[model samples]
Target: MAIVGGGPAGATLARLLAKDYKVLVIDKRRLDSDPQKGQFTKCCGGLIAPDAQKMLAKMGLALPQNVLVSPQIFAVRTIDINNKLERFYQRFYFNMDREKFDRWLISLLPDEVDLRCGSQFKHFEQEEDAVRIVLTQNNKTHIEHAKILVGADGAHSLVRKQLGIRGLVPREYISVQAKFTAKEIMPYFTAIFDKEITDYYSWIIPKEQHLLLGTALKPRENVSSKFELLQEKMKRYGIKLNKQVEKEGAFILRPMRVRQLSVGQSPIALIGEAGGWISPSSAEGLSYAFRSASYLAQAIKSDFKNYHKHYLDNITPLRRNIRLKNLKAPFMYNSQMRKWVMLSGLQSMQIDEN
Candidate 1:
């Protein structure tokens, strides 16, 4: 079997079946080498939720100290722009060195699994018994024939496009993850909500030696100017995000259709953001990516005939809930509704508001 895109989803799927199958995992990243300081993945805040942590531990892939960027966060402070309402939630997320995290996961894969990093998947042609995949490495082209093809490639997935699936309708948001210096990175996360800029929100996530500041813009427009606006808002909260050292921007995959998972027949499957398994509320992909891959691996192990149906049966509710959360975001935010929510016992970290 062949898995394209050696990300969290692909890596997790490979680990699950590698001992039994000769899984070939391909990625453009060089997973074999050690990363220099200040290296991270593109378009990633590198935050993992509690559920994802449990999943990793259960899979026998414990997170090492080298991969952690920050300690477990216990709370998130949220600020609304309209009325300047603020609230604190007990929920939390863990941050990591994105590059190191990916490498660590790659290390957990069975040595028997063929991990071909620095290689790119170009295209594939389906045959009677196996699919022939074209890949390029060191400027040389080669073909890989597999009994099954798994598309774990990300948002701009060539696999999805090749399958003739329609592009993300209503489109997705444009977001940027920027790193800035801080005196000491806090354990807590921050969310700044402003309807003027975006319906989703902006965030300040703590890391080991730096902080990650990011924002998502809806289909309406990009948030370059809004990013400036965020810097100003952050100043009021005593967080100065000046002189951005590094920045990466990309399109966040928003679910245009709830039931969209795989586009091809039995032997082919789509996983991760390629299948639109991204979280609707936060645009978070790791948890869903891992979950989708887990389900897909299970089905493949059971029976290929029941793969699609089994996956759909298991993931239908997950997609539905995300759709509901996306629909509720606009109404749940905004100044008018927030004013009432604050009055209805919402807590705040901002002392002036108290």
Candidate 2:
């Protein structure tokens, strides 16, 4: 079997099925030895939410101390820009370095699995009994054959596109994040709902010594202008973003419908964001990635020939979770509804004013 991504989903699948099947995992990033050498990092909040923590615990995995960053979050400061409302919500999240976290997961992979770093998946072709995949590395091309192919390559999955399936359309956004040095560490994550900047949302995450400001903006729009405006808004909120250390961006897919999710067909399968399993409300994907990979592993272990059927059946709860999130999205995105909720102080942390 071959997996085209080395993120959480692919890594988990490879690790689980390595002993049984000859698994091969390919990733474009150099995550093996010196991951920092490339200076490439995924644009993410690097937050391990409660659900994701539960998933890790279920897998019998313990997060190493080195993978964790300082200022463990205990609450979320949600700011509604238009309504001029601010509230703190009790939520626990583990803040860590995304690259380091991924590296740690990759390190856990058994020697039985063949891991390839800095290798780009060109494409794949499914024949009678096996699937042939083309990979490029250092301007060289190579082909490999596998009985099963999985695409856990995330939102912009070329493998999913190659399947020629016009899956349900999900709302897409261009996510841009800037890392800035922080004078003082923040104890909580900040969630911004500023319709002026994005109908989606913006966020401020603290990573030890640096603070990350990111927002999801519509594609083909003036993203730079919107991001600048967001920064200005932050300044007005008494939060001044200092000198930017780095900037990154990526495509974000928010699935609003359960039908958007897919585990793929027989020979070809998908997982994680590639299969549209991300949370529509919070855009949380780690839990979905881990859970999907686990289900896929179970299916392969039970009956490899009926992997897709078993996977689809196993992920019914995940799909139902998506539906529940969809039901809650309006209470978040709708300004009037959100305003009422904030005013009601429902589940909001109370801070006494002296």
Candidate 3:
């Protein structure tokens, strides 16, 4: 089996399949002796809900205590256009060091899984029984023949493009994430919502010795300016911009068709954001990525006819509900729809709105 993109999805899948099949995981980034070097510029603010934690624990992985940014987040605050704030108490939440977490996850993979980093994919040619892949690594080009090919290459997936799968219709939403190391503040996860301004929210996640502060907005809007606006908002909320750590941006795809995970092409599958498993509302990819990886692993193991439904089951409902709610937001604005959304998330996730 050939797995492209050795991030969370590819690493997890490679680990799972290595038990039964020979798996090769390839990635473009150089694999340094230092695990932290594998950490790419991820847009996630590193907030993993309890359910996701449970899944990771099942995989014999636990969030390293030292990397734990925040454990007990009991409050969630949402700020509106007029600077009106509604705060709720969250029951549970976890803030983590994304780089550390990813490295930790990748470390769990078995040595039998041929993990190749700094390998660039050239293209692929389909044969009778397998697909022939052309890749370049260490300044040398090579060919990899696999019975199955899995694309976990993320949003701009080269595998998806090579397979002639149309990209998901670009949505109007985009997220800009910035990580900062500063003194902890407020001891909770907070999201400030202002529709009139950005049509999205600002987040403050307090971590160990630092805080992950970010803002997500519609893609059509000027994101650079929006980041400045978010910084000002953070200042208003009493968050001091002390030290800059890292900054990254991502585009969010809404409720759109995922052409990657089709069963039409036998022995080929797509997983993670490359498969369009991101939540349309929150753009949360970790949970969905985990879910998709597990499902795909199972389908590959079992006698499954339609894997698309299994993959869609993890995200379609949430995506549909979010789209419907967004459509009604114009009418529901005065009814505290934004506040309700935040509260509902806290309730469903069993986390306090801080």
Each candidate structure's TM-score, on Cα atoms with residue i matched to residue i, is 0.89, 0.97, 0.80
Better of 2 and 3 by TM-score: 2
How well is each residue in 270-353 modelled by candidate 1, as lDDT tens digits? 888877788776677887888888888887777766677777666666677677866765545656866787657555444232
Better structure of 1 and 3 per TM-score:
1
lDDT of 3: 0.67
Among all windows of 10 consecutive residues in model 3, the one with the lowest summed lDDT is 255-264
lDDT ranking of the models: 2, 1, 3
lDDT of 2 by residue, 42-81 (tens): 7799999999999999999989999999889999999999
lDDT of 3 by residue, 205-317 (tens): 77666667777677677778878877876787676777878777776554433332332245567777676666555556776667678777776766445545554454454
For residue 73, what is the lDDT in candidate 2?
A: 92
Each prediction's whole-model lDDT (CA): 0.77, 0.90, 0.67
Model 1 gets an lDDT of 0.77
RMSD per model, one decimal: 2.9, 1.3, 4.5
The C-alpha local distance difference test score for the whole of candidate 2 amounts to 0.90
Where does candidate 2 have its weakest 10-residue lDDT segment? 33-42
TM-score of 1: 0.89
Q: Give the CA lDDT, 0 to 100, for residue 316 in model 3.
A: 54
Highest TM-score among the candidates is held by which one?
2
Best by lDDT: 2
